[model samples]
Every structure is written in C-alpha cells, then in structure tokens.
Target: MMLSELSRFGLDPFLKMRHMQDDMNRLLSGLGTATAQAFPPINLWLGENSVVVTAELPGLSCDDVDVTVREDTLTLQGKREPKVEGENAAWHRRERAYGSFSRSVQLPFRVDPDQVQARFADGRLEIELQRPEADRPKKIQIKAA
Candidate 1:
C-alpha cells in the first residue's frame, strides 16, 4: 500500500510531520525574523488627483505612530508596547508582535507635502496625499491643420 493511502486509515505518517512543522514555526515566530510579515498592513488607493492610504493598527494610538511624506515616498513608523502581565503569570501562546516598525511606500507621482493630511481613529490611520500641480498631467490643445 502507498504511504499516502495510510491517511484513509487515520494512520498518516505525514500528520506527525505536519504537527512538528507547526511547532517549529510557532517557536521560531517569536524570534522577530525577517520572514515574519510586516505589522499594521496597509491599503493604498490612487485617484486622479490624490492618493489615499489606510493602515490597520489594532493596539496602537495616534501618539504611537508617525506619518511622513517626502516628494514621492510615504513613510509610516510606529511602535507597539508589550502588555504588562503579573509576575506570576505564565504564557502558553503569544502570536502578536511588538516593538518598532517602519514601512515606506513609493507613490506613483510626486505629492505636495503641504497638502498631505492624516487622521487616526479607532486604531486605524488614514492619510490623503494630493499630487503636486507641477507633477500632474497637463492637457495640450491640438491645432487645426
């Protein structure tokens, strides 16, 4: 009988391997390695005149985050503090990540730094960036032959 057929009898050898892999992944996730995903994932939208960005920051407040726009790049930097627990408390599982994180995105066009606006509410951040007048496309009139 094939090894794959053992799954039908509830004796799959691969099941043990899968459980070991999960255990290893959980143990290594706490190391804060580059393989981990970026915190506070973001969504970006580009419009004819402006760009909008929204980021999910579940445990962060406005004071913890900083937004900056320079020419064609937008940077989001923030820190999440670990929750304090009692001295006798023991942890069985911890998946949430804490510490400083910075994410920078390059915009499609140059933005007017003065026209940038940001708002943070309900653990979410929204930023609006207006394209610079000089960087916007201009319509040229066609001459009749």
Candidate 2:
C-alpha cells in the first residue's frame, strides 16, 4: 500500500514529517524537485507607467538568479544553497530553506522588454519594467465646436 494510504490510521503526521525531511535534504544538496515551489517571497507594485517587483532572496548572489520579462509576464528562477563550513559541520537550528525555486507573475499591462532593469542588493532583487509608450494612458482634450 502507498505510504499515504497508511496515513489513514493516524500516521499521517509522521509520514508528512518524513516526506518534508527528504525534500529538505534534496533542497540543501542543490538538487531539483519536480514539486518544488516558489521561495524567497516577493512583492509587486504597479505605478503609473511601470511595474516594480521586489523579491527577498537572502544568502544568494546575482549569479544564482535568472529573470525574464515577456510582454505581460515575468519569470524568476534561481537556486539558493546553504553554506557548509566543513564536512563535520552541522546546523544547530536550521531555519532558512534552500532549493531551486521559480516564480512567474502575469503583469497587468504589457511592458517593454528592452527597457527592463534589474538590480540586486542586500539579498534583495528589484526589477523595474517600463510600460510601452503606446500602452500608457493618453489624455485627450475636447475643443469647443
């Protein structure tokens, strides 16, 4: 029987713990998991003519990140690895999660891909996308007739 099936007998918590442990191990080892979800939470802001995205990604470098901008979508992919001092080193209380993550968001309006800018500082990644000139709202004036 599948392990999850056995959980019907009040062993669900234990099985879940075991599964989480295994996934954590795979993450720390920089291995990919088909079920891996988005990590390093982010915030998105919409401006009059731009969209700003700020992602919190501590203990990671620019080289570990990849950002792509399409007409109306933004994709983020990266890996974060825990540092190991030595082979005998052990973590006392591991809290931070490490693993490959991907996050894609659909933008409210089309953006100029060539004008997108990205900056990484203090473990945070900020992306700025410019709205296309044609997409920006234009004000029209009615003349007396």
Best by TM-score: 1
Clash pairs, model 1 backbone: none
TM-score of 2: 0.68
RMSD of each: 9.3, 11.8
Worst 10 residues of 1 by lDDT: 31-40
Please give the CA lDDT of all the candidate structures: 0.91, 0.87
lDDT of 2 by residue, 1-145 (tens): 6777777665565766899999998777765545434576889999999999999988888999999988899999988887768988877898677777888999989999999999999999999999999989999999999
Residue-pair clashes per candidate, as listed? 0, 0
lDDT per residue for candidate 1 within 69-141, as digits (tens), equals 8989999998999999999999999999999999998988899999999999999899999998988889999
Off by over 4 Å in 2: 1-37
Candidate 2 Cα deviation (angstroms), residue 81: 1.6
